[model samples]
Target: MLYPPHQPLQAAAIPPQRGPAGPAREDESGPWHTEAVCRRDEAGLFFAPSKEPTAARLSREEAAKRVCARCPVVIECREHALLQPEPYGVWGGLTAAERRVVLARRRRREMELKKAASAPRIAAAG
Candidate 1:
């Protein structure tokens, strides 16, 4: 019996690489990087919108927080913001007040966890 001719398989097309000009880099130490990411435009200013507002008033600070909320590198931004503990402006999707609330909550949780972890040691000593 004669064997059938082997069919050639079509190769997948590879996408062309664009030279440079990619998205902005996330710099942790650069001043502009943090400020630029948090800066609010004119529209964002003079408004105080809620996080999930339905026709709520919008303020400059709120707008700044909203913008940061959707940012790609928000986690890093938040970490930097936490380290700096900035008194004003938005960082990592959180306003100055919000950041303070988060920091407080974080500290409380850390203390709780530490206490729990040390409780066993105390019990063992007794």
Candidate 2:
């Protein structure tokens, strides 16, 4: 699920890779990346090659999403992608096109909320 607009976006804070590492620090600083499955994987898996065909791109994106599915920082990654409006590759299991859709929906929802908030309410009839 996407992060709520009212709340500050926060890292998911999933458990660190097996074994004790003392208490996991709440303050993240490049530390949240230590547990990412993609760090040990190839970049090509997440990005498209030049002149890629539609079928190949689809296959590659699916593979990238699979990696993201098991990723620990998927939420944080997704938020980054959506907020940044990343124009390429897959992040948080969503392809570029998918991220566009999410961002559009979020923008519409925010607009609707703002509109409703400004509208005056009618008093109940006695």
Candidate 3:
């Protein structure tokens, strides 16, 4: 169900469960989630508390990313986030802002690819 299940694994994304509970892993969403490192850490570490101070939030995010760094399922987690376009929290080591940037870049890249594919090819005069 997640990203067609055939794409090559890459670093980074997550789902809309970006609430205070953090990322959600369903029993049928496949087994990659069972191995997430974030599962062992506090959910609050990934989601920001309302009205949290800037410095504290950054520190917490860094900590969460540290956990994600060693995660074996980081790629799956990140892909989930990007596909779902998770609106908040950190997933697969990326903060919400970072995910937005990534999504934008993906959109731009997709457009470029589509344009290239649709362009006319020039023939050589023999």
**Top model number, lDDT:** 3
- Clash number by candidate, in order: 6, 0, 5
Per-model lDDT: 0.50, 0.69, 0.73
Error (Å) of candidate 2 at residue 106 is: 0.3
Rank the candidate models, highest lDDT first.
3, 2, 1
- Residues 59-79 of candidate 3 have per-residue lDDT tens digits of 999998898899988887787
State, as a TM-score between 0 and 1, how close model 1 is to the true structure. 0.51
Each prediction's TM-score against the native?
Answer: 0.51, 0.74, 0.74
> 60-83, model 1: which lDDT tens digit per residue?
556666666666657755665676
lDDT tens digits by residue: candidate 2, 1-126: 322111222433343432232233335544445555776677788888899999999999998888888888788677767765668888878899999999989899999999999999989999
TM-score of 3: 0.74
**Which consecutive 10 residues in model 2 have the weakest lDDT in total?**
1-10
Candidate 2, residue 112: the lDDT equals 100
